[model samples]
Target: MTETPFKISIPDEKIALLRQKLELTTFPDELEDSGWEYGVPLSDVQRLVARWANGYDWKKHESQLNSELPQFTRDIDAEGHGTLSIHYVHKKSEIAAALPLLFIHGWPGSFLEARKLLPLVTKGSDNFPAFHFVAMSIPGYGFSQSPRTKGFDLAQYAEVANKLMLALGYTEYVTQGGDWGFPITCRIAQIYGGKHSKAWHTNMPIGEAPKSTTEPSLTEKEKAGLERTSWFHRFGGGYLRQQSTQPQTLGYSLSDSPAGLLAWIYEKLVNWSDSYQWEDDEVLTWLSIYWFSRGGPTASLRIYFEAGNHSLGAAFSVPEPRPTIPLGLSQFPKDILVYPKNWTREMGNVVFDADHESGGHFAAYERPEYLADDLRKMFGKGGPAFGVVSGHSGYA
Candidate 1:
C-alpha cells in the first residue's frame, strides 16, 4: 500500500453550500426557562449557529490543522472487505527508538481527539518515555472512506487499524483509546497481541457489573460513579438507542440540516464532558468536522448499529477471548459509564490503573497531560510494559 501526504482542503463549493444552508436556517421553539435539563439550550445553538455562519473562520482553522498535524492516507485491505483508503496522523518523536502508539477515536469524535496528545506523548525526554504515534480516522469518520458493504463490525474495524499500523512498518506497537476506541483497541490486542500489539490503554474502561446478591462495597467516589452511570442510562442514552437501532432514520436530518446535526452532537459535547468551557468557535469547529466529513456524518453512526447487531450486546459489554497483553486504564469520573475498580479487572490483564479526580469521555482532549503521563508511566523504564517493544526505550 502506497502512503500519500494529505491536507485538509474542503472544496470551495462545499464551503459555499454550507454557508447557504446556514443562512437559510430556521430555529425551533424552546420551553420557557428550560436549560440543559431538557437538552442543548436553544440559546446555545442560536449563538453557535450565528457564529458558524458569520463570524467563524473555517479557512483559518483549516490552515492551522494542516500545519499542525502530519497527515497521510493509505489504502488498507480489510479482510472480507475490499481495499479502503484510510486517513491518519503520524507524528514521530525525536528519539528514533521511541515507542510506536496507535490512538483510535470513536463516534462524535474524529482524529481531532489526538490533536492535544500528539505533542505531549511524542516529545522525547530523559525522565519519561516518548512515543511515535498514529491516530487513524476509523473508516467512515473524518476524511477516511466509508465501508461500502454491510456487517463491518468490531472485528473489521480492528482489522483495518492493525493493518494500517503494520503497513506503516509498526510490526510491534502499543495503543491507547477511549469511547469506541476502547473496544476497537481491545480487539486489536486480542487479535494481534504478542506478535504485533504489545500492550493497550484506555481512558474509558467498561466492565460488567458484579453478579452478586450483595453489591460490591464501593468507595464514596465509586458510589458516586454508579449514580452518574445510572443518570446516563436514564436520561443521556437516547442518542445511543437511536444511533444503534435506527441511525439511518436519524441520519437524514443530520446529513441534511447543519442545525439539527449541531444540536444533536452539541448535546453530547456538553453532557459527556466534565463541564469543559467550550468556546463558540471550538464547538463550531467540532461540528464543522462532522458536517464536512468525507463519509457524511451518518456513516459514523453505523458503527453502533453494526456492532449492536453483530456483537454480544451493547458497546459497553466486554468482548470475548479477552487479550492477555498488558492493559492500562485511566479512570475519569465524568465518563458516561464509570465502573468500580474491581469490575474492570475482568476486562483484561491489568498492569497500570490511575483514577483521575477530573476529566470525561474525551480524555485525550480534555486531560491530555493526565493521559500522556499515564502512558509514560505504563511504558517508561521500570514500568510493566517497558521494553515490550524491543529497542524502543523512548529515551534521549
Candidate 2:
C-alpha cells in the first residue's frame, strides 16, 4: 500500500454549488418560545446561513487547514469488505522514539477534531512525553471513501483503523477516541490488543449500570452526570433514533439542503459541548466538512444503523469480553452520556482515570490540553502504560 500526500482542494464548481444551495435555502418556522425545546432555533440557523452564504470564506479556512495538517491517503483492505482509500493526518514527532498514537473520530466529527491536539501531543519536549500522531478520517467521514456494501459495523471500522496503522509500519501503537470512537477503539483493543494495539484511552466510556442489589454511591458530580445522561436520552437523542433505524430516509434533507444539514449538526455542536463558546467561522468550518464530505453527510449516518443491526443493540448496551490492555478514561462533566467511575471500571483494565471539572463530548477539540495531559500522564516515564510500545519512550 502506497501512502500518498493529500490536500484539501474542493473544486470551484462545488464551492459555487454550495453557495447556490445556501442562497436558495428555505428555512422552516419554529414555535413561539420553543428555544431549544424543539430543535435548533430558527434565528441561529438564519445567522449561520447568512454568514455561510456571504461572510464565511471557505477558501481561507480550507487553505489554513491544508497548511496546518500534514495529510495523506492510503488504500486499506478491510477484511471481507474490499479495499478503501483512507485519508489521514500523520504527523511524526521530532523525537525519534515518539510513541505512535492513532486518534479516531466519531459521527459529526472528522480528522479536523485532532487539529488542536496535533501540536500539543507531537511537540518534542522533555517535560512531557511526545507522540507520532495518526488522526484518520474513519472511512465514510471527511475525505475517506465510504463502503459500498452494507453492514459496515464497529468491527469493520476497527479493521480499517488497525490496517491503516500496520500499513504505516506502526507494528505496535496506542489509540484515543470518544463518541463512536469509544466503541471503535474498544473493538480494536479487543481484536488487535497485545499485538498491534498495545493500549487504549477514551473520553467517552459507556458502561452498564452496576448489577449490585444496592446502588453504588455516587459523588455530587457523578449524580449530575447521571442527570445529564438522562437529559440526553430525553431531549437530545431524537437524531439517534432516526439515524440508527432509517438513515436513508433522512438522507434526502441532509443531502439536498445545506440549511438542513447545518441545523442537524449545529444542535449537537452546541448541546453536546460544555458551554465552549463557538465562533461563527469555527462552526461554519466544522459544518462545511460534513457538507463537502467525500461520502456526503448521509454516509456518516450509516455507522448508527449498521452497528445497531450487528446485534450491538441501541446505545451499544450489549456486553462483550473486556479488553485486557491498559485503558484510560477522561471524564468530562458535560459530556452527553456520563457514567459513574465504578461502572466504567467494569469495561476494561483501568489504568488511568481523570475527572475533569469542565468540558464535554468533543474533548480533544474543546480541551486539547486536558486530553494531551491525560495521555502524557498515561504514557509518561512513571505512568501506567509507559513503554507499552516497546522501544518508544515518547520522550525527547
Q: Candidate 1 — number of clashing residue pairs?
A: 0
- What is the C-alpha lDDT profile of model 1 across 1-396, one tens digit per residue? 999999999988998888888888899889999888889899988888888888899989999999999999999998888999999999988889999999999768999999999999999677899999999999999999999999898889999999999999999999999988988998889899999999999998887777876867889999999899999989998887788888899999999999999999888888999989988888888888898989999999999889847332555555667789999999999999898998987788999999999998899989899999999999998999899997888887
* Candidate models: Cα lDDT each: 0.90, 0.91
lDDT (10s digit) by residue, model 2, range 29-51: 78999899888899999999999
Candidate 2 lDDT score relative to the true structure: 0.91
Name the 10 consecutive residues with the lowest summed lDDT in model 1: 310-319
Candidate 1 displacement at residue 231 in angstroms: 0.7
Task: Please estimate how well model 1 matches the true structure, expressed as its whole-model Cα lDDT.
Answer: 0.90
* lDDT of residue 117 for candidate 2: 98
Among these predicted structures, which one has the highest lDDT? 2
